[model samples]
Target: MRGVGIEVNEEKVGRTMEVDEKSVSGTRFCLLLSPDRMRGSLCLRLERFRPRLGSLPGRRQRVCAQRRSPRARRETSPARWRLKRMSPSPAVVVLALLLAQHPSADTLRVPLDYTSIQEAIVAADDGDTVLVWPGTYNERVDFLGKAVAVVGREGAQVTVIDGGGSGPVVTFGSAEPPGARLEGFTVMNGNYNVQLRGGGILCSAGATPVLIHNIVSDNVANYSGGGIACLGSSPFIIANTIVRNRARPFGAIGDGLGGGIACDGGAPTIVANVIEENIAGGTGLSGGGGIACYGGSHPRIDNNAIRHNVAWSTYGLAWGGGVFCTDASHPNITGNSLLENHVQSQTVEEGGAIYCFDSSSPLIRENAIRGHTSGSGGAVHTSNGSEPTLVLNNIEGNDPYGLVNDEPGVTLCAVNNWWGAVSGPYHPETNPGGDGDPVSDGVAFAPWLASAERLVFVRGWPEACRVRQGGDLRVELAVFNRMPGFQRFWFVTSVDLPGGASFGPLAGPTPLMLLPDGMMSGILGHAIPPDAPTGLWTYHASIGIPPHDTLDHAQFDFEVTAAVQRLLRSRSLDCLFPSP
Candidate 1:
C-alpha cells in the first residue's frame, strides 16, 4: 500500500492532494490530477508497477508516469519520466512544477480585454502593442509618455478615430521617443483652439513619434494647423492623406493659417503626403491653405502632391495658396507638385503656388507648379525681403504671371526655370509697359532658357496616341533653331516610356547643323513588350546647343492598348515590333 500527496501554490490560493495506493489491485494506481490555480490543468497517467521477483519482501517497483497539460496538449514535450513506485520503506511522491510562459512584449487586444483604446493604453506597460479591431473609436487617445504602439488590426479605411468635433484625436506630448508609433487609422473631426493646436495629432516639446499610413482629414483649428500642428517637435509625418481640413475664422484678426499642416519652430520631415482641398479662412493675413511654416520652422517638404487648397481673407492680404513660409522659415521645398491652389481676397493676394514673406529663404527646386491663381504672383510670390532660389522647376500654365515680387525694392532671383514660353514673357519684363530685356526691378527673369528643353513635342499625334501592347511606337520630332545666327547643335530624342517599353537604335542625340532659320527633324522608335501595362506614356526630347546648354525640349503623351492582335489584323505595321 502507498500514499501520494500533492500541493499547489498560486499567489494567495493553495490546494493539497493525498492519494492512497493500498486499496488498488494488480499494483496499478489511478490518480486524477487537477491544478486549477495554474494557467492550464494537468493530467497524470502512471503505468502499472512491476516488482523484482526474487528480491527482498519490500523490494521497490518502477512506474512510468506521463504528464499532459490541458492547454499544452498540442505542444507537449516527449519527456515522460520513469520513477520508483511507493514501497513499504517510505512513501515516494513526485512534484511537477508548471512555470507560466510570459512574453517579452505583450499584445493587449481592444474590446476583447479592454473596452476602449485609452483603457488598453492605461493598462498596458511600455513596449506593449495595443491593437484595436476594425471600428470607429470616438474617444481621444493620448500616449501618456509610454513607448508603446497603438495600431489598428486592419488598415486605415476600416479603423477610424473620430474626435466628434472636440479635442485632438491623438497627442504625443509627453516627450515620447520615436519608438512610440501611431499607425493605420483615419483620424478626423478634431477641433482645437490656439492654445491647443494639432487637431489630428500633436507632437510637441521635442517628442518625436512615428506617424505613418494615416488619413488625417476634416479637422479644424481656430488659429493654425487644422489637420496636424507641430511646435518645437520633429516628427516623421509620412504617407498621410490630409484633406478638407479648415482653419476657421476667429475674431477680427485674420490669423487662421495652415489648413493642412502647420509647423512652428519645428523640423518635421513631411514626405509623400496628399494635402488637398484645405481652407485657411480669416480676415487679415490669412495664408497657407495647404501647409504653413512660421517662427523659423525649417521643415523638409518633399515628394508631396499639394492641390486645390484655398486661402480666403475678406479684409487683409492673403498669401500662399499651396504653401506659406514666413518669419525667417527656411524650408527645403523639393520634388513636389503644387496645382490648382487659390487665394481669394478682396484685398491683395500673392503666391498662388508658394508664398515667402518676412525674410524666409526657401529653396524651391524640381517642383511642378501649375494652374495656381492669385491676385499677384500666379505661380510664386515673394515679398518683405524674402529671397527664394527657384531652380530646375517647371512653373507653367499659372493664371496671370509666372513669378511676382509684391514689394517694390525686393528682387526675386528666378534662375533656370521653364515658364511656359521660349521667349522673354516674365514679370517686370512684362510688367504692363516694360522692355523685352533684363531689368533690375521686382523680378529678375534673365538667362531663362529659350524653350522648355524638358518638354518633348511629338507632332500630329492624337490626345492619347494609342499603341498596341506588343507593337511598335514611331515618334517623329521636328527640331527648330530658335537661337539667333547660324549655329551647330545636337538634338537628342528620348522616350519616358511606360513599363515594358524598350528603346530601339533609331533614338539618338544625332548631330546636325542648322542655318539662321533652319528646321531639322528625326524619328524615334520603341518596342513595347507584350506584357506592357495599358496606360498613358510620355516621350521626351531635348535639343542640346553649344557649351553645356539644352535650349529646347518637348513632351508627348501616348497610350498602350491591350488589343495587339486586333491592331495587327487591321494594319501592317512597319516600325519596331515585339519578339515573335
Candidate 2:
C-alpha cells in the first residue's frame, strides 16, 4: 500500500485523505477512493494499476466523488473533466479526470526584501502591493505606469517621503489606472523649478490615481501647484491636509497659480481636505492661494475647510485667496467653510473667498464663507462674463462687501443667502451712487432668506473684569438661533484660566429645545482658586448639534487680580446692608 497527503485550507475542501491498493494483474492494479456523504475525509483504495504500459491494462476505472455545492460544479471545468451522476438528489458523481489550479497575489515589502521603493516596484508584477515601513525616505518616486498600491504599513503620522527639495515627489503618467494609489505618507519639501508643476505630486496625461489620507505640505513650485498639480488627469484627492506650500512666479504669464492645488483640463474630486496657509502668485499674475482651476477643468470642491491662504500678484491681477477659477472651468463649490483668506495685489484684486472669471458658472451652495479680507468681493468676486449661482450660503462677517461685480453689464444671480442679516446688508461694487442701500448695479440680490439654516451667535458680559483671588466669577452668554425649524441644541462653555487652573462645567452640554428665532441665556460660574496666578483668562462658548459640528464660537478675555481688602469690605457691607 502507498499513501499521499494533501492539505486544503479552504472550508469547502476536505481535510484528510487515505488510499489502499489491491493487485488485479501483473504490474497492474485498480485504485478506489470513498468520499463521505458530508464533511468527512476523502478515502482512496487502489485495486489495480499499470505503470510501464502508460495506460490501464484492464477496463477503464471510475472514481467517485461528491459535489460540495452548486457553485462548486461551475468551478470545475467541463472540457478537461467529465462528471456522471450516480444518484439524483444530493448527487454523488464518478469523475474520469480532474485538475485543480490556485493563484495568489503578492505583497512586496520595502527595506526587508528590497532596499528602496522604486526597486520593489520594478521587480513587482501587476496587482501587487508595496508595503513601506515607518521611516523617512529621501527620494523622488515615480509610478512608471504600474497598477499597484504603494502604502505605508503604519499611518501617515510616521511614514515620511521627503523629496530633498528638488524634483516631483511622486509622478503618475497616462499608463497608470485608477487602481494605482498612494496612501498614508507625508509628502513634503519637493522643489521643481523647470517643470513648474506639482512639487508634491504630479498626475498627467489621463492618469487617475487615488491619493488619500496624506499630508502634502511645505513644497515649492515655480509655475503652479506647489502641493499638487493635475494636468489632464482625474485623481481622487480626499481627506488630506495640504498646507504651507508656495507657487512662486508664472513661467511667462497666465500659468503660475494654485498654491495648494491646481487642476487643468480634468475633473478631480477634492473633498474633505484642510487646505490652509498656502501662498500663491508672488509675481506675474499669481492667483488661487488655496486652489486654482483653469482650462475648462471641472472639479468638485466639497466639504473642505479652506482658511488662512494668501494670493498676490506683482505684475498682473490677483484673484481668489481661497479659490480661483477661470477659463470656463465650472466647479461645484459646496458644503465648505472658507474663513480668514486674504488677497493682496498692486493691480486689481477680487474674491477673498472665491474668484470666477471668463464665464465659469460654478454652483456655490450651502457653504459658510466668513471672515475673508480682500480689495473687492470679500466673499465672492465674479467678473468678465462669469455668472455663478449663489444659493443657501451663510455669507457673513467678510470685510468690505459680500459680493463684488467688476463689470457693469454682467449681473450676478445671488438669491436666498444670509449676509449677516435678514435684509439690506450687501454692498455691491457696481452701484454708481455708493449709498449702502439695496440697489443693483450689475448685481441682483433679493428674495433673500428670512433666516439661516443654522446660526449661533455668542457674546459675554464684563469683557474685561478683575476678580480677586478666591472670588466667585460669573460669565453670561446669550445664544440665538435663526433656523426656521424647531430643533434641540447642545451648548458647551469652557475657560482657559491662568496657572493651569481647570474650569469645571457649570452648565451644558445641556439640551435646550429652541423655537424659530428664539434666544437662550445661560450663565457659567467659576470659583477662582487662592493660589491661581494673576493674568488674563480666556472664556469660550460654543454651540452645536451633536457629532462635533460647531455652529458658532465666541471667545473673550478677562483679567484676574489679587484680593483687595477694600473690595472685600465693600462686598461684606453690601451683603450686610441688604438692598431694600
The candidate that achieves the highest TM-score relative to the unseen native structure: 2
Predicted candidate 2 versus true structure: per-residue lDDT over 27-46, tens digit per residue:
11111111111111111111
Q: Could you list the CA RMSD of all candidates, in the order they appear?
A: 31.3, 32.5
- TM for every model, in the order presented, reads 0.59, 0.60
Q: Identify the runs in model 2 with alpha carbons over 4 angstroms from their true place.
A: 1-103, 250-255, 427-440, 455-580
Cα error, candidate 2, residue 454 (Å): 3.0
RMSD to the native, candidate 1?
31.3
lDDT against the true structure, each candidate? 0.63, 0.64
Q: Stretches of candidate 1 above 4 Å error? A: 1-103, 193-195, 407-410, 427-440, 450-580
lDDT of 1: 0.63
For residues 1-580, what per-residue lDDT tens digits would candidate 1 score against the true structure?
1111111112212122222322221222222222211111111122111111123443332222233333434444332212232221100000000000113567788888898999999888766778778899989999998877677766577889999887788888888775577777899989885555778777788877767668899999888889998888877776577999988666567577899998988788786567889998888888899999998999988757688899989888788999999999999997676878999889888788898999898999767677778875556888787889887776777777677766776667777766666664444435434222222356666566565424211121211145666555544344433222334444444344466363321232333343222223322335556786777665555555433566555555676778433221111111111111
